[model samples]
Target: MSEISREILSVGDLNRAIASSLEERFDAVWVSGEISNFKAYDSGHWYFSLKDEEGQIRCVMFRGRNGQVGFVPQSGDLVEVGASLGLYVPRGDIQLTIQTLRRAGMGGLYEAFLKLKARLAKEGLFDLERKREIPAHPRSIGIITSLQAAALKDVLSTLARRAPHIPIVIYPTLVQGPEAPSGIVAALKSAAKENAVDVILLVRGGGSIEDLWAFNDEQLAYAIAQSPIPIVSGVGHETDTTIADFVADLRAPTPTGAAELAAPRRDQMLQELAAIEQALSQRIHQRVEREAQTLDQFALRLSHALPNPERMREQIQHWQQRLKQAWLVRVDSWSRNQSHYAQQLEMLNPQRTLERGYAVVLNAKTGLQAVRNPDELNTHSAFEIRLADGVANVKFAELESRKS
Candidate 1:
């Protein structure tokens, strides 16, 4: 027997070595392909396979990283993912750990969308002022799409659940391919000419931009704008915006949303009616209370203003007695004031001052001269002193300076 020397490695060790080597070489790479076998776990992790025409690779978008993707991906949808190549250590399966994901081939369609949008906007087809308001309660609703479309079921279901009384008019037409544009235009003309439905709904399930390009027809846009009846465009998912959305009377994110917009829920209408009845009842009650209060006030005012012969006589007697008392009080006050003023005048009399031992002196040359100091007097200076009722002339016997 010949013994063969070989290197024996554990499965864990081999997987780890392969993972490390893959991460080192394929760090930060982009992979583009159609999505398949997509499954979203309750843990918020996304598991799918990215496959091209030739081959496919299993992929995972973890909860933490997948939240950044703007649109929800579907099977058969073309997408591009940026990821790192890794090996699932538990299963030793080769897989890609996705970091970012976005719809593939959107750039060209987005550019075309922008250009068409600009052209239509310049033509005033997208003017908000011209967009008709969707009727709050439509009598009949018209739907334009393929008879076999999945969206038809959703719309019918929602409308039945919300408002079963409303009538649904479905006009079968081609919603894809080159023939779709003319088909949609013919449907619009038919609906408009019939005038049976109050509003029309153009709805379809979500699809890639290429599949939805039929709705972007320039002629279809003009037809929608020219339609007399209001049109609600609910094509594609919420994130998907088509040219018809701008030209339609209203834009809804989904087919069910468009149906809801078409008719009002019966239960909600009943609730609103109940609310209005309650409000009106309360208003009437308040008005009655206010009027009652006003009547009471008026009654009180009338009672006060009304005259009784006996009460008028009593009032007149009371006023006459009060006037007499007031006049007596006024006379007494005047008498007291006169006595006080007379006493004050008597005290100011000059004779009374003289009697009180104050004398008035005057210079003989200048009568009643104001001599502020004794220096005003001199030897042989004649003076007059007024005493009570008499005036006396006097002469100084000697001149003396007390301080000088």
Candidate 2:
């Protein structure tokens, strides 16, 4: 060994040198391990230990790098980390500064999917309001999938069984592999340009994350959103979900399901039409019966309300006769009363009483009676004596007093 290399070095200096050498050798390497003793500081840095059955290493993921992680990590989770080896100068401990941390296998894809979903959702791509409603009865359907895909077969069989009258136009494209997303996007655009189909069915058979990754493409999702045609995404099995599913106008569980959604059963429509016809017939029959009854009532009312001049004149004459009779009776009663009252008045009248040998004397000037008592009489009195046929005048100088 060289004498310089043999010289003693402090622990910090040695750790720094070792760290530099380790980074130089493996600046970026993938390490697979389970996490333990995870700690997230207020500074947005993550400190943890990556461990295996027999070995472990200290790791740190700073705020800048970990912010890109869509999810928080838990202890004991299996993870794959891309990092560089480093040592803490203060403690002289071997550690890794994680540049990227991903859950192993499909977890990485899930994280990316979640990230894109959040971004697109915030941008309103997956808004329920923006989603186009699928037609209840599409005249024709455009399918974008590989012609050899089992999904195509399933969809065709379902459509044929459910609604044989509806025609289908297939826009064939790759559904898997790296080039699949662009191909699928092109097919969608072509279908939209054709404008022949009421709705577009974007479908594929279920597969692994890698195989279905094409459906998760951001551009493909945007294309589906902007397409003039409504798209039903049936890209995978019931449990599988992709970015296309969210951005699509509708998501079906399988290709057959998408066919069912797009096409209404012919038998069901026939039954509905029959029901409507029967209901209309019943409503018309009831309305006709009701109107006939109303017409009969109206005829009766019209017959009653019809004017007859002869009958009206007869009624008027009858009323007039009755009124005349009533007036005559009243006149007779009044005549009888007048005759009876005239007899009474004649008997009571002073002139008539005078004719009956009784007289009424009243003061001539005032035409009032004077006192019969001599003590109350005026010395000179003038009176009008009323007789049966004429009036008589009398004067008296004194009143006569007679002893009993």
Candidate 3:
């Protein structure tokens, strides 16, 4: 009765359908396996195979996602991955697109870390207001770390290079193992008791969560929070975070970074000082210039307010010339008046009248008396007549008188 209708799929269609099915059917999953054939490319992508005893699967971690893993993965390392299952359409192969990767047994440690972080955060240990400001120029810097630890050497070198003038005090302590927390706390207490340092650096090198677990201790966090001097925590690499980092006043990415934060660079400080000196000089110069300009303006105003010497001298000269002309006019008028008076006195002189043909008469007996009328003269008396040149004498001849 019949050949049933069947659907045939092409290879590309089959692969795409399978990929879609795998992606749709599975959410993100956690898988435990040992890594093998772990190859990292220049592009920063990782391609590896994850296998247990019986089965294996291919996996890939891209650069954008893998940097958060904190540690590089090696072949034969046991790891747990959170990933999504998918099929590669080109190869038609099943694979995992990994989102997160960690050491297999570290799940519990990570969980404990999260819980402790949350608890401490709720207690306000990470509050910004409680934090101290790091001194910009610390008098002395203290370091809390193991003497044998490489982190100590790194910190010492960094401090020496950046700020050679500042003194450094090392409080050597255990940085690992079960006893590390108590050792760190004791060192911190000792540093606080001394009260000699302006800032303290708590440093350690990079390691796995197990190796760095001491820094996550609750006691260490409290010690960091209660420290009298400000603390800078630099435990592990940049990606590693511990409770000490959260509780400290400042957090640095590495041991060297902690030293740099605690000690200011000498060269940079000198540059800043030079800049400040220049600015102060400029301000002083500006103030002097303003004062000088004001003085100049006052001088100009004073010059306008006072009289000019040259103009006063010119006015005096003009008045002197007027006075000289007036004196000359007065002297000329006096000369003219004297000449007129002299001419009038000449006109009134008796010698001038005598020179005009006039004569004077006087009595002969008394030569000083003049005879004016015939009645005064005796009939036989003599009289005298005086002229300009000579005098004459005469006698009366008749006794007749002329009536007027």
List model 2 lDDT by residue over 50-104, tens digit each: 9887999999999999999887786656799999887788887888899999887
Candidate 1's displacement at residue 121, Å, is 1.3
Q: CA lDDT of each candidate?
A: 0.81, 0.80, 0.84
Q: How would you encode candidate 1's per-residue C-alpha lDDT over 288-345 as one tens digit per residue?
A: 5685566556555655776774665566557556755665576567557656765764
Error of 2 at 129 (Å): 2.1
**Tens digit of per-residue lDDT, candidate 3, span 129-212:** 999999998888989998788998899889879986676777879999999999999999999998878999999999867789
In candidate 2 the C-alpha lDDT for residue 392 amounts to 81
Score residue 380 of candidate 1 by CA lDDT: 68
lDDT-based ranking, best first?
3, 1, 2
lDDT of 2: 0.80
Badly placed stretches (over 4 Å) of model 1 are 1-107, 308-404
Clashing pairs in 3: none
Q: TM-score for all predictions?
A: 0.55, 0.52, 0.55
Candidate 2 Cα misplacement greater than 4 A, ranges = 1-106, 307-404
